[model samples]
Target chain A: MLTAQSTKQFKFINIDRVALIAAAAGLLSTFAAGFVTFKPNRIAAGEAFSLAASVPLQGFLAFLALWILVALLSISGIRLEKQAVFTSICGGSLLLLTFFLAGQYATAATLEHGSISRISPGTGMWIMVFAEVVLLLNAVQRGGERTRFVTALSAATVAGFVFLLLTGHLNDISIMKEYFNRQDRFFSEFKVHLLLATSSVGAATLLGIPLGILALKKKSLDAPTFFTLNILQTIPSLALFGILIPLLAYLSARYSLIREIGVQGIGWAPAVTALTLYSILPIARNTYAGFATVDPGALDAGLGMGMTRTQLLMKVEIPIASPVILNGIRIALVQAIGLTAVAALIGAGGFGVFIFQGLGQAAVDLILLGAIPTILLAVAADGITNWCIAVIQPRGIR
Target chain B: MIELVNVTKEYPGTVAVKDLTFEVGDGEFCVLIGPSGCGKSTTLRMINRLIEATSGTLLIDGTDIRDYRPEELRRKIGYAIQSVGLFPHMTVAQNISVVPGLLKWETSRIDKRVGELLDLFGLDPSAYKGKYPRELSGGEAQRVGVARALAADPSILLMDEPFGALDPITRESLQNEFSRIQRGLKKTIVFVTHDIDEAIRLAARILIMREGELVQYDTPENILTSPGDKFVLEFIGTDRALKRLARLPVQGLMRSALSVVLSDDPGKVEKSLAENSYLWVTDNEGRLKGWLDRKVLDKAPFNMEDSIVRIRVADFAVSPDSTAKEALSKMVLAGTSSAPVVDNTDLLVGEIRLADLLEA
Candidate 1:
């Protein structure tokens, strides 16, 4: 008999072909595209510079060395399957090096061109960011230990960047300059952004869970309930916010208590309300699907074992369906985080204020000050919820 | 004891069970057998209130089952099904301890009971206790299912085609183990199955149903000999006699064999075989060695001492726990009229003759 062990052959490099292709594309872009653009003033067209010309010689050499090392590892006779932690740490460090070099290049360009010049990361830097994201995703796909390694590595990188910013090492960068100019407002806006996203998701959970259960129990309600939530989702975020504003304004004008509680038409209340409506579809749909897909045999067994309806729901159905439900919550949370950025249009006081101001002035660095953190928040929320789903899920099912 | 009085279960446009009435005495293994959709399963479910009867009275120990809450009633009645339904997320020990835990059994008591039940089902408690259902083989999962059902030591058990999903060989072995467990526990069991042979093998009294109505209700022997109707007779099939033999263990028909020690003097052994035609030789521990034929011995130029003891072949002996049908088949294969019966330890207990089996 030919056993699996006997038939198996060892492979040297275990990296995926797609990852290799992506890495090559990333390295090519650094040589072909501008690493940073330096403008004499915010309104002027900037001069583009290659990665080698933009950063110091040492930083550029370090970047090239890191890329070469990654390329070599991709093809070398060394398997990373068992050494995922090492692979992730190596990949993460490469990402950090790229970011650090980009920041250094921005600072160098600003100082060299005089203080009046503003420097923004260029096409090559964006390509590098995309490549780093792909590499991180690949590490995450390895699952279990690799995912944990990648998550920890990401956290460490973020912490290191924050430390550099606090120590004034990155103050010369245009985005950091924008942050320093409105430091107090930026902090407040960050809090408000979080508050909007969290409260909306919280409200959605409270409403959607019961609706989902009701839809499951009363089959007649399933179609209509889901349709309503789906329609709510289909409406554009701006239009939904538009609708909530006038409705809330009328209610607050008519009721003293509504006004007293700060339920104004153009603030966090309307923003959160719109977001909550948008969040319902994913939350409710996944809950219903998870409950519906529960093993019928297990349900029968639970009922036969004398578990009451509530006990069965709490002990068996909910626990078995948790991972799916949490996945739904993850989708809703990430969506809400991204959508809340638009709430600043309604004076909701979040990072979107800088985004709009940057757009009006055509200031790329100012826009990135808001956009980068918003993207990071979404990614962080997605990762945390995924971890929760993995943790709370019962064994054997996975 | 459980009694169903005029129980009828009606679905939207059909009656699943119609005017069904039956009484199972305490400790009786009552098997409900029928074609699919004959309401046998529906009857079993109605007893546990998994399906409520449209109109009927179900009594357990002379008290109406409806008087108690369904959850409370179910907790008191053990239930198992064809799928086993061992919770995939829970360990075997946890699955077995479900009802006991629900009934507020102390942690230590539930643990002890789980160990005891695992042992009764022939599973090593320590080895199987922590295993999830997915880790278990089909037969082992089914055993755990049964062990779980019996965990709380309920006075009654309801099984719905409990071994229906198993392969033939595993099914037969499980049936034998089930019989042993049933005999030891003596719970008032109401089992449902479509397999007439399985019904005959395990049922003390068999209730045959046809299209939601009772066709026959009697002991296995009576059901085979005097089926109540054409449906009942046809349902039992033409191999009634063979199936009857399946119900009788070899131990029931086995008789004490005329034997001699393996160390017996060859002349005496030959003389004894000469009188009996055949003589069984046993070791000091009473385990069978082999038989000596008088005619073969008489014609042999064999040394008397060397020829006295012969090694027994595997086919020449059957376990006492095996069915008479199994023994008969072995006898036919070995081309012998009789075979020695051994226990689990391979100690010879008695002999079963083909003629004696036919007579029984």
Candidate 2:
């Protein structure tokens, strides 16, 4: 590759490879557990089965492909060892393959419901524990070397545990069963319905960033856009959903397109809509700030160096302002997560399910179940995303 | 080669550069110098199309600057500024390779060029390639800026206070190094500086500007000897005499008529100086030894070389065309009553006293 020299300069020290392998293993195993426990048959029937019997097979296959590519390049003497690109492609593909396999395995497992006794800590469980151990070791050793690594690992570990609990293991075990049986236990069931809410936050990011850019270019649009988001946020979430029900139902019947795009009933539709509306402000504000923060002299330098407008924006301006954009995303993400709990009013089951269920029965255990994970998830998401931002930070930037 | 034709830049309240006209011949080292806000920077920036000219034309090798796009024009002209402006994120090698990379040169060639530049600037290519700007000292970074600007081997180089951020010792050393490098490459250069000393040291021809107007555009010697007006004279300042003497070779000032003094004949110096009030002494090979006073004849037979008041010949002289003001300063600095002025060959000509120099 043309980046061979650059690759050499950025080569992972030999000790880091073990950490990388461990991290990859942990991610693979966590994905497998989610697939297995979330399967309908496994949840309903409660059977003991190895979740990811096929992972070893898939991992071996991936390793083989990577090995072959490296060997071929080395034999040909092309000097094309782009480690970062190579690792990303190989790791990403393996993770994706694992996801596909888990999905298929879960569908099969969920097909036939069994008793709760059928679910035991078996080979799959042991494999997952072992994977976690390796990942933990990697995180402890390599993550200690860098602030970003430590932050990413700590976040991933917390998020991984939450994911594991939501899937089945934490609630299924005898030690934690007392907490689960409480009538008002918020997170009694391992249903992570937060994805629906999180998706809206992502959607908001996609829409808000562009809108903010446009607003920056055209100052006239700023006030109106700001007012609209402000009004959306001002309305109580429950009231907002109550208002959306009639309007959405009418719109849904009138236009099949609205229904097709996943905005159906007042449940997820209103919840997602409310969360998305709440998310726009921070992202928009941050986008404007990011664009405005572009160094004028740097832009001039880019132009002075013969960079086109597009090149200058993409390579110079954006990189320089990326920290601000990342901060905007962070603010939006945290806000959306909190507001998503409010979606429980319209049957949009998030951690808010625990809040509402606990309130109805006056069960503190139930409230703790739902409330704890919700806060943890938001905190974990914030920490991880922030770590990712720090990792990719522009080098020379002040 | 570059020419500024009746160029004038006017702001709301003032003209930044007015009616400036000059041609920098190919391979010439021309410096633009003045105090701050003298429009030297404005003039240099206009060359790269950084600032649009309010009126008149800037021609680079004959083609008007407006004929090309700003980026294209800048790429063809190498530029270095006081701040260095190196991308902090980029490694030393990457920073140096920017223009070449922009031009889409092959990676291997770019690597080779970057290495060559680092070596040329006295930095080890291996040690510095991946290191970012933050790791470099000020002098190293400034040199890197120069290397980066020259990456494309542009025919014309423009610099605005490139070494202004550095300590005096580093700045002067870099100036000398750059001067040495320029002598070989001979790229047409337009250097901007606020220091008149730096201007005289680096420039073959100096353009003195003040209040957005060209004060004088002449050789350092001519500028010092004959200022265009009071402004030019004051701008060059009272130190012009000392500064002008600095430019002259010491060979030009030493006295050629001197009594030869042998190491063995220690007493011969008093006998040789008996007739003349003070005898100019030299070694066996006829190089200057020192000055011997006639009263030394009464003293113990001291070797002429031992008692002689030896002055560094290199430090004692002024160029013949040097202004009387310059010669006087040299005499004062050297603590000599008179100057033993010589031609370029170190052959002593005649003496010029402090009184005569003052009278002139």
Candidate 3:
């Protein structure tokens, strides 16, 4: 009777509706879509395999059991914190288990069919990965200990993947095979990717903050300033990079100063210029908004109390507006990270090298090698900046 | 002393203040009162140079205000406003120490001054010094605003409706507090407000303005009793006499209290009760203890302990500094014809009668 009474309260209590949808989708994909795909060579159409194909019976049962628990936790009448924690743990385990099963089958196939054969994650595996990520992120964001919990979960996931890699468990996976072949090139390209993005964003911030402050100081500059920046942003990153190539080549060819600075037609010079130009709009616009939002009464009182313009800007304006200003940098950073992937097309090497290379050769695993890490890097950068904003924001604003 | 000569502030489309001339003596609590847009606030801002007069010779201590740099002049004149404007990021102590820090005072001096100002405003230093402005109530934040203004102890203060944003109960208590504090510090203050009651309560001299011009300037008593013009007459309101009486402090109107110590002769107390009907009881130190009615003495040879009805000092006594209006209201609320007047320590010093308030 007590159990029945408690179960009835589920309708009235806050239901984890998004979790319900994700878990249901996860279950459907598990039954209908292939667990993995097998190809005799890198470029051939692959054969799909469901769970019963080669997954160990015991391991299969455990995956199903944990998946059901994850779904049940979503609907059960439990404390919110407990629900978040349990769902996250179960969701994380399911992701690792799915990958482990794929890795196991890939190894078995590679030994029989010889090393040139490839095993890429199929539609079902990708859908399952998506569902698990959504559940994990939802749980993390809803919890009170958002930053600390996210950091711990990410660290644990990284450690788990590294343990699998060092033990040769995932060596035969198609993406891992691609990684091993191009390990040195991959590391160099990753370095280039991060350097290009960060340097561009750094330059944008240095210039954009003052531009924003200038717009805020002079009402006449506001429309014209935003107009120019908006136009620059509207130009697609690819098109902007293209435009910079000819313009920089012309300038560097004529001026020794430009050539001395290593400005080039198709290298980091054009890439950095295009990226920095693209980054400035968000920073400048948000800076203007942040400073504009400061209370006018505070400015009046500050001036009335004998603060010089510099003193007011430093002591009163900056501290109060810092959180909003940092938020602009966060936006600029995320944009620059994604755009830097495109820079590899013009000989500025990054993770984009593998993506464009994979596209030319029609190699799905090669594309995954480049694409997955880029996505993760963006998420990590976003998390770090958000944590900064939370830390520095004034208690009064809270 | 500060003087303004032929000061005018003209915008392109309008004149905010025109040909205004006034002198505020040192240590004066001067209030500039009028309806909104009367240029009273503009006039106050000119003294601190927050708003520069279009054409004027503003003098402080026989020196032209323009002789000193604007920031230098403002640093020497403390300023506060209705919004309080305490920095949301700064703690109470940090906010209070801003001016002193600007003036480059020593760290120890600033800390000590901040502590003293916090105590002066009745905010416990240990409890409130580290608290951000958001943590404070409206009344408390306004107290910190005033405290910050006095942090550097400037001789001149420019206040524009410093307590205008508070609820009635809080406003009254803060007003009473500021009045007491000003009586001690006595800065050359030029305060701007639209509230006439506030002017009557705080101002030693009232400057009435209308349409960028002076309507009348005089002491509160004179402004209430005599009309400089029809505008001044209408501005003080129809309850002029009551307000006048309310402005009259109970200290001047009170007579010596008729009372005996707790150990005094009961026969003598009973005898006094026949003539005055009510007799006050006090301790040897003169702190008010109780009261007696002749009816309580109806029992022949009344016991001193039995006949002395216990009275709580808060319920039975009024402060001597309180206006006649406050004493009358207390007497009416307690259903009595008179109330004993006391000092800050609640020592009985005098008596105020309802008849005396009405006659005044």
Candidate 4:
């Protein structure tokens, strides 16, 4: 009884660990690593600037304001639910401002030095972004999920980014300069990259979902089907591309039909095919798992209700299993986006063209020009799919 | 009417049910009961073609079962089970509307019917219709389960221990509610349960089974007085007479209660006590608060309502809807020949006595 009474009194000290970690990480990174690197030339080693030196008075004050806001929110004894929502909002704002601050610093430095000088986000900027992401993820896990508030916040963030781009606030950043130089080529390559990823995953969805259902239905086909897909997945991407080149060259060379369909030794045909093969396991396994784990009682009840087999599958089984299936699709999509860069190895055009070019020239800003957008695309896909899954799920079960 | 002739379900090696033959009369509440492995669940499923019998000439409403497509035939009958198999993704209204929707009933008609069914189960339609199955308590879920079964208003209902998973109090109350619902619907119900008390309380006719063969099919009264064999006797247990009292509702044995409102004229308590020395005390809502001893009250100030001997309903009262056996147990615990009967909300309604119950 005495212990219980003491424990009740001590309950006021419940700490929000996620907020503390995010704040601590942000503070540590600000001091340990500078916020931006100012370069004399495209390929020269740059001088890094600490947070205080990186931006002018207003920008520095703005950072201090956001930090104080976060600190206050962390220490205040608010209800966990409200605290989580506010904390995530603050995290989102902090992320946007960090990039904006770097952009402002870049523009100011370019004016002071010369047009030839370049500025890039440094390690501290990356760490701040990471911290904010951790903060946002923690909030979502704790309380912010499935609410229109979060969705609206995501929309506002996207709008803010578009506004920043349109206003040319970020123009002086080195990566944006790379983007402007190859704007036309960049757009076309971006389309090709998206198309490659989409078509392969789409084809896989068409083939793999049925295969998954079939695996569950035909017990005999289960092992061999997964085995083949597993073997396809185990082959290194480069090795698979290499193997496909020789095989496809021979087939296309020997057959008019293969040549007519553009099944060449290198390029999109093998890239897409490899990507699709990589995608099938996640989609099919998740599909199989989704259907296999439906409550037996529900199936029995559905059967007893006199639903035809097709009706049962359509109306009951599919809806219950949709979230799991979509989760698989999400995994496949993010993975496909990442691997599409590797497809550039076999002469497939994508952001990887710039990446490889940057690697050849030993230019870090040029590499960031390709790598940053690819990372953003993956993050966007994950966020969108997560929203879709949350919307599709029934409130009671979730 | 459902008729099964030589119905047997044979797995690879074992015969789950063997040569089961029976004819359930129209509108009859026939209970198929026995220990586990008695194939009662299998037999119930076979009615809906959930499990195909190895060989049988099964007829429903004077037609061979195989003549209709399995799905089409199952649509014409209502089915429920112990798990209450409500679709978690669907709301109560949608779950109940499933069969009706399959039959392509108009939307307005389906909505009205869903509301009616929800109201019939005593769940407020607006409050419960939009709720998902996971949101409901076990008893509420089972209620919705039965409501969903009756949605299409089929001529027959098949239940496999629908209330079996609930707590004892909830189970008993649900059984009473089901009995009341069954009485009104008059739908042919083939219920499967292992509880002999449940079978006795709800079933109009009982089919006793052992080792997947029919042991006896008879009325509850006959089954209680005479058993087919030692197995049936032991299955029903040794307290045959006590179990039989469960069939008699307390309301049937209840007399007009000698109850007085506490704020009523002081003279009325003494006048009411002349007929019975034990005076039941009630409040304005007709809820039993306590009882008054006439001899003790005679010397005390009549205005002393707090001085009345408090009788908690849980310790000394019986529900009007409860069985005589339940009331008898309560009466025995309270050491009284007679007990005050209350409604579900414990509003005093009448009185039942040990003598009256025994006479009945």
Which candidate number has the best lDDT? 3
- What's the best-to-worst order under TM-score? 1, 3, 4, 2
The residue-by-residue lDDT of candidate 4 on B1-360, one tens digit each, is 999999999999888889999999989999999999998999999998888989987899999989989989999999998988888888999999999999999999999999999999999999998999888999999999999889999999999999999999999889988888888999999999999989999999999988888999999988998988898899999998898888888878898887888888777766666567788889989999988776765675555465578877888888877888888898888887888998888898899988897787
Error of 4 at A339 (Å): 1.1
lDDT of 3: 0.88
TM-score of 1: 0.89
Among these predictions, the greatest TM-score belongs to 1
What is candidate 2's lDDT per residue for A1-398, written digit by digit as tens?
65878877884433335434544454454444432333132123333433344335665455445434433322343212233223333333433343444434433433444322212233343454454444333434433335354445444555555565566534543223424455344343324355765687788889888888888889999899888877877888678778888888888888989988867667778777777877888888788888886645445555666667787777666776678788888888887777777777687777777778767766444555566667767876798788878887877665
Worst 10 residues of 3 chain A by lDDT: A142-151
Runs in model 2 lying further than 4 Å from the true structure: A1-197, A207-297, A394-398, B8-20, B34-38, B210-215, B249-297, B301-360
Question: How many steric clashes between backbone atoms does each model show?
Answer: 0, 17, 0, 0
Across B1-360, the per-residue lDDT of candidate 2 in tens digits comes to 899999999999999999999999999999999889999999998888888999999998789889998877888888888878777667889888878887889999999999988888889999999888889999999999899888889999999899999999999889978987898889999999988888888889999898888888999989989999998888888877778755664344433454555563654556667777676555555555467777776787655656677867778765565545556777789777776665566545555666554433
Residues B1-360, model 3: lDDT tens digits: 999899999999999998999899999999999999999999989898889899978999889999999999999989999999998888999999889999999999999998899889899999999999989999999999999988899999999999999998999899999999998998999999999999998899999999999889899999998969999999999888877877899988999888988988877877778888888899999999988888876778778898888888888789988888888878888898999999989899999998888777
| Order of candidate numbers by DockQ, starting with the best | 1, 3, 4, 2
Tell me the docking grade of candidate 4: medium
CA shift of A143, model 3, Å: 3.8
Give all candidates' CA lDDT scores.
0.84, 0.69, 0.88, 0.86
Sort by lDDT, best first: what order? 3, 4, 1, 2
Q: Considering DockQ, which of the candidate structures 2 and 4 is the better prediction for this target?
A: 4
- For each candidate in turn, the TM-score is 0.89, 0.65, 0.86, 0.84
Chain B, per-candidate TM-score = 0.91, 0.77, 0.89, 0.84
Residue-by-residue lDDT tens digits, candidate 1, B158-270: 99999999999999899988998899899999999999889988999999888899888999988887878788878999888878788788988999889988777777777
